[model samples]
Target: MTSISILKKWNPRPTSLSQMNALLLRIPVSSPSMSPRRYSTRDRELQSAKLEIENAPIIRNNPGLSASVFRNLSKFIRSYDLMDHMLKVYIYKEGEKPVFHQPLMRGIYASEGWFMKLVEGNRKFVVRDPKKAHLFYLPFDSHMLRLTLSGQNVKNGKKVLEKYLKSYVGLIARKYSFWNRTEGADHFLVACHDWVWFSCINLILMS
Candidate 1:
């Protein structure tokens, strides 16, 4: 079945978050497959960009800027140029509001929210096709997850947040072939919550 159809039929259980967590935890690790040779195009492009950056000449035109500040000014310039010209990101549309696809534009975590809004709406780097994407964005707000799941109570918040994130990842992993292709190596999340460090680490390790 098509991903869209599969997504439509698949439903998250409303019994409890713990039950959902149990189901998500059982999502098996997908075996690496070599069938999708189309990804090789992205690999080639990255290699080309890397070579170009490595061979780039030093930018001595800026008299005010010192080379000491940057490890390699030429490489940095080339990297930025390549990213601006070629980067394409695919955002999954399977998530719901407050936690996914919604941005929190206030408070200390505002940067993550603003970044999500900008990137999701961006035409230059965002692509609708997963095949053309160089990266995948998991658009979940950590702040919102905390608020929606745990509220003012902080007890076991870390575990709750981690489970929710894991469940989201599991959903996408099952809905699309992208996550399994790289085993989430190309997937990224924008989270700035204080507990993000530990939660993200646990998520990655568990995934």
Candidate 2:
């Protein structure tokens, strides 16, 4: 057979990721790398944005890739700055992409959407209708005193649990007439710390 015919007969598409990588390596193709000088400073900042997602435990726990979470993580990583991060996240619909952001940090933070949505929902439950009941946000010192004066040990005790507990106890409440494990006790258990901090714990713990 002619050389042209031979080339056509032997040509094959790489069938696996490893094979694809080997094929690309054989070619003179250049991909963006960790070269400090290759990309501009702004490009590096954009790349750093992915760190948030990579660091998130939810993303790390995904047995497989979660596309939606990855996309959102990419968006946050590409944010121009922390302020930009806040604005783009809080001001815009998460489903939309910002081309202005790119070269996201890396990896997938698999768990943010589920957690954040629950947080927002809990907040809404507190303020679904402001006109119906006056919302009072009391500081911790005042809250403690209010609890003390009212003779409620919700804040001080470890087990009596007049207050929310570390475990699912808060959600499971030892005395609920409608208590059922299926009633979203899991979510409460997972997000209890977040709820405390949001209310007025006044401290943030990484663990």
Candidate 3:
């Protein structure tokens, strides 16, 4: 199911290959389907990705890109395109502000906030249905959490963050069958905090 292979499965290929490519870009690797299995769409998407990666050609740059760099770079480029066309990300709606969806614009960690805002605002790669997404976004605003933690005891702050994340993830796991299906292999957390290592300790333990 490589993107190219998927395109070729149809009876009449589009006259404009580029247009077909563009349309394919909107087809996420995992999408809501009429299948009984939870991973039916995921499996299909994974097959497509695997085929696309395996079939990507190696572009020789002679003296330009080293062989190793070329291979890695090519893989990244091909994978990125496939992801753009087929990666569907779902942002969770649980939790309240100061920790949920608020973005911090004026700080070193603002990049994470900005990234979150952009993704949440961008509809091209986002879908309302969780079942249709390839990746699940745990939209915890670490920037806001940092601010709130500034006033709390250091040890207590860490525990608080861990508790919140555990609770949040637990809620999703219990309320929906997604986490239970894959053990959260499809879920991701977006963060730019220098302390992300410690902050994500809970996520690791739960995973």
Candidate 4:
């Protein structure tokens, strides 16, 4: 199957609108044909994590998890534990501030700002080397994007936002191989703007 098809099959659908703010795509890792020395460290680590999650034993009567909250409490707990211990993300250092690396901490969308701040400042999950990252982060703030670009008096603000995001994705794809690897199946962005979903629909449909 094509990479995008694989991604569509594995990517989880958000259960509610709240979950849509942070859409995390799943990366499919096929068994490597190359020798251990030739294989990339990121791929090896991701494959290891996948295997562990798949093989995790199902637990019953978990007090911390409610059946109403989780579809599969056992798998959810296992995944969370694995993510805590092994997940490494690399944030791209492209684009300017206020719209790119900067966060807006005083608005309804402030949660997105806080998330970006915490993740970027985090030392444990944030890695300097992209080769060691299991996932790639595009650290643009949706609130900032709307604030900065909406003032331009563009005829269609939504299209402008979409174009800007598409341009950013294109920029990253040309400069790095990660997006090209699985057609951005492992990349994620957190946005809280109301129009973000519509604006980034094209990017979301990429894989």
User: Which residue segments of model 4 deviate by more than 4 Å?
Assistant: 1-39, 204-207
Give the runs in model 3 whose Cα sits over 4 Å from its true position: 1-38, 62-71, 150-153, 202-207
lDDT per residue for candidate 3 within 152-207, as digits (tens), equals: 66556666666667777888888988777767766787786745555564464365
Alpha-carbon TM-score of each model against the true structure: 0.76, 0.19, 0.72, 0.77
Clash count of each predicted structure? 0, 4, 3, 0
Any idea what lDDT model 1 has? 0.77
lDDT per model vs. reference: 0.77, 0.31, 0.71, 0.76
RMSD of each: 13.5, 24.8, 15.1, 8.2
Ranking by TM-score: 4, 1, 3, 2
Q: After superposition, how far is residue 136 of candidate 2 from its true place, in Å?
A: 51
Q: What is the model-wide C-alpha lDDT for candidate 3?
A: 0.71
Q: Which residue pairs come into collision in candidate 1?
A: none
Q: Alpha carbon lDDT of residue 79, candidate 1?
A: 91
Candidate 1, residue 109: the lDDT equals 90
- Per residue, candidate 4 scores C-alpha lDDT tens digits across 111-137 of 998998999999999999998888899
